[model samples]
Target: MDQPVYSAAAPRILIVDSSRNNLAVLARRLGAEGYRVMVAETATTALGELQRVPVDLLIADLALPLMSGTELTRVVRRELAWRDLPVILISGRSEADGVVRALAAGADDVVVKPFHFEVLTARIARLLERSTRVRQLAADNATLDERVVRRAIELGEARDRLKALEAELGRVG
Candidate 1:
């Protein structure tokens, strides 16, 4: 299938799945969609990769060798830097309890096995868009704060000058 082309600077995605076949399929699909894909067989390896490089999104399988996807999501959310990172948990089990647990663990979305590629891509796009909006809002807030601080300092200086002029007038009069 022909995938839509992204910009030269494609968003990076980290995929964690113990199954080699699953890794291959997802890597091919995401890459075709103009994403820079990185693969890890376990949650531990995924964490190590995360430390070395920044990723825009994480797609993890529910079942892993050492650490499960839910645990990985929890750890990612706990880290202040990665708290806003988008996480999508994929699993064959479609049980209600598992879905609840995944959400509680900070997964932004969940997908069941045999899911359509279109649906997965759509979900990914939504999450990325939301993340971008949040980052922009934060940057705007920071700029506004700096401006407020600068204005306050200027006001203080003006007040000091007014006081000095009043004292000089009293002495001259």
Candidate 2:
């Protein structure tokens, strides 16, 4: 879609899957594609990594040993800061059920397992691009907020000065 948004610093992706083999495969693939990969074998570790570093994208597999990807998405979305973060849920379960659950839990997209590396990479790129745009919009909003606040303060000061001058003139009169 949009030209791939290239950055000097590779985008970070947090992959949470209990299967060590799956984690390794995903890490290798993403790393080769220029993404900084972070692996977590459990939901706890994934949440901790999120706290320590804001990841560009999250790819989590349902049917994890202790915690499912759905649960992870719920926790992340509940937190105000991570609510808008893009999540891609991977599952080997029934596609319909898994997709519905992932969406309910706040995943941006869901991918069934037995996926091709190229397909996954394309999806990752799309998510990264979307996230980038969202972040840019947030930055723009913050800039506008700052400007509005500054202007409001300036106007208030000017009004105060005007009132003071009027009081002085009244006394003089």
Candidate 3:
């Protein structure tokens, strides 16, 4: 009998861009590079996509149709606090204020338009790696918390039994 082996799925990237060309090109390129790509032309649709499927990373255009990527990042950061999703905002503008605002709004990284695909890919990898580390740390913390609680409960039970034993000895003597 042969045992079944499970393989990891490719990382899923959700890209929100109002431009059809941007969405199409990125989906094609990223998919070719072995990433499962999901594209949305608007932030609202991007939110819907998030609800429908689990995404590893988000690459959003700064200038979306109904909502800007900054706004979208804020909403995702707030509403999906448990998910801790990594967000990258790509924009045509290079102003320092715009970059600062996006970061303040919870974007993990920002990429300027006409970016090299290699650089974008590197950023995605870094963000995903960081996110993975964070999740691992959180899981470790939860396990530690459970162990502490279990130990405390055991200590309490032992103390209770000790008291009962003392009472029995007192009555016997």
Q: Relative to the unseen true structure, what is the Cα RMSD of model 3?
A: 4.9
TM-scores of all models? Answer: 0.92, 0.89, 0.92
Model 1: CA > 4 A from native: 1-7
Model 3 alpha-carbon drift over 4 Å, by segment: 1-8, 81-83
- Models, CA RMSD each: 1.9, 4.3, 4.9
Per residue, candidate 3 scores C-alpha lDDT tens digits across 77-122 of 8885524899999989788888899999989999997799999999
Give lDDT per model, in order: 0.94, 0.88, 0.89
Q: Clashes per prediction?
A: 0, 0, 0
Measured by lDDT, the strongest candidate is 1
What is candidate 1's lDDT per residue for 1-173, written digit by digit as tens? 67657776788999999999999999999999899999999999999999999999999998887899999999999999899999999988788898899999999999998899999999999999999999899999999999999999999999999999999999999
Candidate 2 per-residue lDDT, tens place, 1-173, comes to 23334355888899999889999989877777778889999999999999999788999998777778999999999998898888998988666977898898899888887878789889889888988899899999999999999999999999999999999999999
